[model samples]
Target chain A: MPHDSAGHTPIDMPDDPDARIIRALKALLIGRGFFSADDVRRKIEELQSPAPARGAALVAAAWSDPAFRAHLLADGKVAAAERGVPVLEAGLIVVENTPSLHNLITCTLCSCYPRSLLGQPPPWYTSKAYRARSVRDPRGVLAELGWTPPRGIAIRVHDSTADMRYLVLPRRPDGTEGWPEGDLARLVTRDSMIGVAPALSPSAVGRDPSGI
Target chain B: MDRLRFAIGQRVRIRDLPVPGHMRTPRYVRGRTGEVTQYCGSFRNPETLAYGGNGMPTRGLYRVRLRQGDLWSGYRGSGQDTLEIEIYEHWLAEVGKGAPDAP
Candidate 1:
């Protein structure tokens, strides 16, 4: 396999149009001293790194501290910054999921997401089926994802179509009243942060640290 | 900052223009009326930015909330269920009279 100066196999092996465009753009910028090949490599590695724990930490803090939760709902960027998590791109909006309401996030135009906090979105999140059906049939999509909100709770779908990215602050699970922040963080899964599922109940995941 | 043309709680309709090129407004919302729920601050217009333009004079962005039933016929789910989207000011037109309390 041939590799570029970045020391990684080319993303498009067979000279696809997208590969060609990216290659040309990288060469032009590098040739112009805009950035180095090292920068490109580092960026790719950074994106590939898994960082869902950062988002879960924020959610854990919000669930345990009322003040933090208020700040998160009011200004997600600041809340993330308070926790030392960087939200560099689009503005962040933390939507709360209450007992009577559920929130789901999607990007119909593209695969825009809170990558700075949650790292790369799941492949399923960027699929055409999800992008098309999320806004149209959110409940159906959630059901297919193995989660279905109760009849009394309404579902609200948010489309990140522009400059703002969304994160769902799922409701704290029951039977976790005295759980420490670290343990609470364990219950906050990536799917829960995306609003596809609720936080894991203590009974489901077990209170023992080893169970997680 | 460009003067904001729409306010929160005001009713507005998304314009369905046929201008081609990079756009953030999805086709599913075109020609649909919704309520402004938030003033999301202004940002560089992606349409101009995509084509190497300066994207000067940032545009005001708002989060509009539309009833799922209004957007889709015979929509299932609670009547209160809705969809929220971020839309630039240019794509929105004022609907009726003054702004009311946002539900």
Candidate 2:
């Protein structure tokens, strides 16, 4: 094992049993014509593309249609069942942000997310800093995510457990009413679902950077 | 290990196991009790060694619901609101029923 300047172990792995096993597996898999490291990287990039539109569509539909919103709140699994999105079964709860009591989700231990609704988690969602600080200091974590809750509004931080996963239903942005589902879907960004940012309005669209 | 089963509306206490590597069992609910509001289908436990330590697979997962009040006593929120979570069979035991005491 390689020691740091202070003679202490840093986060990097050494040529220990676990490292040897990973090296062996990598060699065997690469030799067997399986996915190379580059292939895996490409696959992840493909999955993380602008595919959030589908989930955005669902969120927009819920915002526009009260009946659909009821279905979504009542049984999110069945509401999203047609889309073939897998709902996390562990006493998983979906909390919608109302005019009051905004909710945010963080995986304190690991990134346990709703793959069915959001497809794939963003890079920032899995950071060790996010995992550790979210549970202890949720308000600070939200600030780091670039979200500043309004004064006098209480912030509720929900730490996702291994058995429980959480999804935040951000409030619909203003000036989006009577808009088409496709247009509204385009406004629903990944950051909105995580409660870090609000959904984009028609004017805010195309102003932000292209692609996730 | 036998296939564990519990009906909806039944209360169960979550257990904590010192499994090497990754596990889906959250540290907070290690010894907490919550009611089972749903009967999710079963498959091979993902917490098993075969599924890797981390939560990378969902083929053999079970979905369950837990009320917020049940999870935390004196929880202040809308009484109708409930939180749902997916837990593997290995992380649960029937409370005050036929299941053994959680260690």
C-alpha lDDT of all candidate models, in order: 0.88, 0.64
Docking quality band of candidate 1, CAPRI definitions: medium
In model 1 chain A, which range of ten residues has the least summed lDDT? A203-212
Please provide, for model 1 over B6-96, each residue's C-alpha lDDT reduced to its tens digit, 9 standing for 90 to 100: 8789999887767587899899998889999998898998888999998877889999999998988878777888999999988888886
Global fold similarity of model 1 (TM-score) = 0.88
Best by TM-score: 1
TM-score of chain A of 2: 0.72
- Model 1 regions more than 4 Å off: A1-15, A24-34, A208-212, B1-3, B97-103
lDDT minimum window of 10 residues, candidate 2 chain B: B54-63
lDDT of 2 by residue, A110-191 (tens): 6777765676887878988776655445556677667766644555555555444556677887766567777777888877
Q: For model 1, what is the C-alpha lDDT against the true structure? A: 0.88
lDDT of 1 by residue, A16-97 (tens): 8899999999999999999999999998998878488988999999998999999999999988898898798889999999
